[model samples]
Target: MNTTMNEVYVILSTYNGERFLSEQLESILAQQSVSIRLYIRDDGSSDGTRAILASFAQSHAHIDVEYGDNIGVINSFFALLRKVPPDAEFVAFADQDDIWLPDKLIRAVDRLKDASKPVMYCSCYKAVDENGDFLWQSLPPEKEISFKNAIVQNITTGCTVVMNGSLLTALKIHQVNTKNLIMHDWWVYLVAVCFGQVIYDREPSMLYRQHGGNVVGAKNGFALWLGRIKRFFLYRKKNSRIAQAREFLERYKSDLSTEDSYLISAFLAYRQAGLLKRIRYAIEMPLYMQKKSDNLILKLQLILNSVH
Candidate 1:
């Protein structure tokens, strides 16, 4: 494959992101070793975000824009995915606030160069404040990225993701209920692990800016950690992950491998299973979060449900 000739469509979903949008776009435009095009969707922004998009699209021949209703982040991303050009050889998800490194797209394309089927590449990034000052680096990959982990948690963040055209085509075909997916990237990871491949790169590639504007951002430190514990306890009864997993299973049951099918079945059934049954399944389920501490907390949440 000619890396230089590959047409990559970078999809960006925006709301009120006029502040950092230009910087993010500039970084993306600086990528080397591939032909890049910017495709943006404005999710009913009331700010100057549309004006910024309009200005960029008018000056940049490769930039395209779409404006739609504010149907929520997950759906907005899915809507963007649906409109990706049929001939696009690769697709990368972009955030409105983060600044990507120069090599981000090139590295992802190179990693996925020899893939013969649907595949994905996602890398780590530096967590920064709204002003782009460093806060911390994203946690290194502590566990294998698998279908099991994808079912419980979304480690494949959209901003860090670059996927092949085949994966894009397949996703557009088997499109799950976007509303049911906790996130678009998670659904992409699930499909890749079940049918193709997913590569998790530990190298930092972007400045993941943390501001109140992020749909989801890095939450490090004691207060954020404590708030998570409180939120989990408060809303444990309505676990969204479990609901998303259930929806995934029902929609794509025929496509999953026999082993994955069984694992998902066991995971979904854990809530209703007897104590001994739940324990055995939980022990066998090889799911994990990015950190060991997070894994321990997940174990606690599981126990609470089982013994309640």
Candidate 2:
């Protein structure tokens, strides 16, 4: 059991985030329990973001900042992950705009303090407007979180994630094409659920600030259902989410249980399956989304060859 609470290194990937970088940093600086260190990687921001990071790093011994070319968010996050110190006990992801609660680290650590296996804790977050006014609490549905669910969907939000050393070690020693990843957070969630443990917190640990510039935000009921269905068909072939699953399998196929390997391989090759095989995969595979409606949609995608 992990009896000791260890140092938490917060990894923040910043692009053109001059608008809310300081506030995010300040909120991180206020974390409780474990000692905190801030690691910022700038992805070629052509704005005042670098200057702000430099100024903050100058006065804060705990903050370390580095600048690199624009490699997109997924690669940028992996690049930041590579720079983490080998001895770091825990790792958390930070967005450029989210404001974390003061007890975020402590709350996550409390749940993970006794884990012996690779574990990650992710929490719900509050959705706020651009100016930080509260909009609504973004809670996850009380769905079964498992490798099957993770195979087709991501329930973990990166901004609220905290991973133990074992998971980070597994990621560090792995070789996978980060370019094929749909999102770094989703990939990590899949990995954790597949090979380790995942603790989902129902409470908000951070404020997810949505604005005109963000690509994803909180939606409810029918709108959220429709969006999920739309995305199911939106991505296809090798550029699909299932394609990312194929990548995940190739990277760690040797480590996967035989059943898991079979499951993922069927998902990878489902595009090539005949009508009979497609029906078999649709019925046999345990892949699912959090909501029953979305899970039904996933089954339809499998049967209709829409999950390519």
Candidate 3:
């Protein structure tokens, strides 16, 4: 790729991440084959995070830091996204505690360079502990990435996501209401699948740290299954996937294709319908999660009207 074409903007949100902030910044700076401008927004860190960020900013010309109130992760990321330069052709999301590989940005840019429309690239990641010990490698999605699947489940990991300029433009145009938003990455996946393209890379791009302070971490085996069940039952009203879907449809219905709009409308309608209709919709709608067991759980949730 041409040197000028390889420029990328990376946005990161930090919150009391002093323990691994410097290491993460060093890894981002070490990225190869791409010219990077790192924009970091500290979400009101009370720890040494602001001091560490100041030191980096004072020393590095390409790094810019913004210390702001704690508006939560979703809004903080969106704020950083708005700060990205308009001329930027590619943008990637970063976590304050992960160790990015040298080729992470380059690999994502290579995949996204030729896209003409809105497109997103996301890769698998290696889960590690706070001490950087290997935990496990995330598996690739067994099914196709589609709006139907995205409406129900998020397979995209934020730190590994990269997007073309077109998608960023679309996101800016259709601003999201963070009230019911799930995660920044999941929202991006939903938009890309509905309006453009989604590329899921099987290659591991970074060391995803599974530490106590992590906002979200990878879980596997029975632990993962049990956690999902707990969230579905215990936190249904607060973290409803149905509410997220409803928000997406409400905001983008006009721009959505006929089939896509109909699918979402039907999905929302069935949930609000009577018991028999809800059961039929649960069995009939083509929407699904990545895993078979998870898909079954989704159907059960729909049948019982527990998604709300």
The lDDT per prediction is 0.82, 0.84, 0.90
Pairs that clash in candidate 3: none
TM-score of each: 0.92, 0.93, 0.97
Worst 10 residues of 1 by lDDT: 299-308
> Order the candidates by TM-score, highest first — what do you get?
3, 2, 1
Task: Give the Cα-based TM-score of candidate 2 against the true structure.
Answer: 0.93
Model 3, residue 261: displacement in angstroms?
A: 0.3
- Candidate 1: C-alpha RMSD to true structure equals 2.5
Name the better of 2 and 3 by lDDT.
3
Clashing pairs in 2: 237-308
Higher TM-score: candidate 1 or 2? 2
Q: What digit string (tens of lDDT, one per residue) describes model 3 on residues 50-124? A: 999999999999999999999999999999999997667999999999999999999999899999899999999
Per-residue lDDT of candidate 2, residues 1-308 (tens digit): 86554689899989899999899999998887678888899999999999999999999998989899988888888988898977667899999988999999999888877877789999999989889999889777567888877888888888899998888888887866976777888888888888899998889999999886663466666867777656775645345677788889888888999988877887878889898998898877777777777777777888888874
